[model samples]
Target: MRSILPFALALLALPAASAQQQPYTPPKHTAPPPPGIARSTPEEVAQQADGGTQIERDRPATYALAEHRRLTRALGTLLPQRKGVVDAYVLSIALDSDPVFGREAREAGKVLARRYDAVGRTITLGGSDGKAPSPLPMGSPANLEAALARIAEVMDEQEDVLVLYTTSHGAPFGVVYNDGNEGFGAISPRRLAALLRAHRIERRLLIISACYSGVFVPPLSGPQSAVFSAAASDRSSFGCAAENDWTFFGDALVNRALRKPQPLEAAVTAAIAEIATWETRGKLKPSLPQQSIGVEVQAWLKPLEARMPKVATAPVGKPSVDSLQAP
Candidate 1:
């Protein structure tokens, strides 16, 4: 009887051990729908929040038309009946909804327009003080698309170059497109590449001034493009707070380097050095501004450089690293 009892106990333990070795399978349950709300599928939720739908359905028509008209006028100013050697189009996007980005973007646009001889051709898109009619429109996906389309209408894709300088907060995903009280969404690297391709604008210079902007280079870089980013893919940029006049990169690149008589490539190189010094002084992790210049872009940019204005640059000064910390 004792032997039989021991064998029976071992047999019972075998089932328990097998159960312990088995993979976990969570129990599934179908709960009743809420008393009044209807159940929604994942697809339905996504469609409701789709970027295009959010703008069209949520944005008021009157405001939309007013913004559209403003952009049309701005673009009209730049459409030279005869295309120049390089018809530069500057799009300065302030995606963070902060006045600092807005101000910096506007100033950068002016600088690029002056340097590239694109005074009337440059389009500035962002919010501004209520005192004046806002330039272009608030930074949104729709506005960005419209601005690109307008440029395409006037620009000779084969001969002219597009210089797009965007400044704002960014993530690993891409540049952030926010309108403060309006709404916000990310412009993923893939999506931005698609937008540029859709326009069929081949020769391009893209400067992304934002945190983690290096993520844009891999996806957007091509033989006909020169991509510059404010930080490496894993790093954050500085001087993005609401009170500052410019981000660390924007100030160095646009306010300082590009304002001089130097070529775009030289300006980019100088900006890199300036950024490194600022980061070191702040005792912050290096942003490591990145530049990916395609072989073809150098040839494309030569004519534009020939036409660029030679301006006297003020002596470059060190940014107050303490005030330029990332917020």
Candidate 2:
């Protein structure tokens, strides 16, 4: 499995303080600084004095219109929302190029879709195994925003639930997005909160698999939302090797626990226990995955849970923790 060393180093390099501050939306006339130059001054250092004039040069790639059209077509495939029914629209995305996340996204899409009766209303975004051409759109901040907008447009926001599963590397600031050197971006908790709020998507089940993902829980948690994170705000989850089919959290929750005909809460409990055992055996510090289910969300979640398949499926692939060599 991939070591957490590189991920930890990357987190140390990020300005985690940005997450606590208000985002700086560049003025309409201000253009993103040209590539190949970062910044001579610290971002946000002089925000109040300069009226937020500073800019971080490493802007995310603004992909061609063709990419937008591709996502549009994918959105079009979703079945129209059913009136008077509590439907679930599933969106599974892998924000990083690592094959493990991609594989997890693909399988997560299938599992969530089936479990939630969202077979024709599921969208999967990520590369595949790093071998075959990806049949889905690459996951990025822009694409994710576009997808959510599209789902909002087609679904009944009050009655439908948004099942969003994002797998990636993360820092205290946000979930990182990197796609084979062509894409780089991040989705912070505030940014995501704004997106959902803007779309009026009240009911949501968000499962984030990433290091330091617990940062999202506080901002996104609400009476109509359930947030489950792979790691605590200050911790890093393991099993991120590129060649593997699943990360530790993905395997524990999606591959094993959720595969059974249990309630979501029960599944989460089982996954947590399983992960703890694995971590202890490997002599590793606990990642301390977190979960929060809103009180109001249960009213709608029960109907969705009632539709789950009774038969259980066997887990596939090697256990993620098994890759950890003895300490």
Candidate 3:
């Protein structure tokens, strides 16, 4: 699995310039999409006269977009529940220039972390404060670098990590970074994959919520890793929501999907389908949702499927490191 990680994880010496932080490139082939793609359909414009989903409307083109949004929420409530120590790093840098929605994303991370599992193990997440001074200046790159570094450090110091999630926006060709072309912004997929290998993280799982995130899978998806995204490489993701504030994909995963009782992949796939349908009904071109794994997560589950050991119950302040065991 390590041999197949992306370039970012391949060369992990730099604090911020790892392979994931590839140089910026303005996509020349693809032209800008129409502006209405960003417009809000709202109530009257919704496919349903009720201006909601799960309910039907008999209006013109407007009514078709009114979905109730009950889809992924059901799945979130059904995703398989687990217990483990998670070193979460939520980086929200909405200050970036390219219409970033980091602040809301950070909040989504917290929402997922709370119900993600509080007992049976400990979870240490950095960037919970919303803003962490990362290697990248203040964009997608910053979020990615902070996330990768946290994972590397945790693996080097701890063991048996369950998941790693990075949520942010991305340009067609790359993730946003610190400068218009510097440390901050989004990191590349290959570079991110390399970070996982360089840190020697085993059995890692990644969930990336971003627009055009499909571009990342080719380079970052791993044999031992499981990944989920908000939008395909060719489509623009919906964000800038009033409440979620980030992308709808992130909201579905953290707020809705995490609340479910299914396994990780099942929950994610359901969320992808729900979001795609919601967008399509709303007059927006449907974005493709994909689940591509180098190695099926299910393949590695059989050996450890029997039963996990209970976590040590030593007193909180007097915790004993020697008693630590994989749960």
- Which candidate number maximizes TM-score? 2
**Looking at candidate 3, what is the lDDT of residue 153?**
46
Clashes of 3: 56
Error of 3 at 204 (Å): 2.0
Per-residue lDDT of candidate 1, residues 275-309 (tens digit): 88988888889998888888898776887788877
Best by lDDT: 2
TM-score of each: 0.77, 0.81, 0.52
How do the residues 1-327 of candidate 2 rate in per-residue lDDT, one tens digit apiece?
A: 989999998888677766647443211213333243224233322222122121223335664555667787888888998998899999999987777888899999989998899999998887655566566777877678778988998999889999999998887777876666455557788788889999999899999999999999999999999999999999999888876778999999999999988999999999999999988988888999998899899888999999999998887777787788624
Lowest-scoring 10 consecutive residues by lDDT in candidate 2?
Answer: 46-55
Which ten residues in a row are the worst by lDDT in model 3?
A: 314-323
Q: What is the C-alpha local distance difference test score of each model? A: 0.74, 0.81, 0.43
Q: What TM-score does prediction 1 earn?
A: 0.77
Write model 3 residue lDDT over 1-327, tens digit each, in one string: 565457766466565656557644421113222233124243222222111111111225632232112211211232222334333222223323232244444444444444333232222221112222322223333233444454344332232444555554555544433222221223556556656666675565566666677777766666766666666888777653322334566555555555455555666777776676666655577667556665655544432322222231211111111112213
Worst 10 residues of 1 by lDDT: 26-35
Relative to the true structure, candidate 1 has a C-alpha RMSD (angstroms) of 20.7
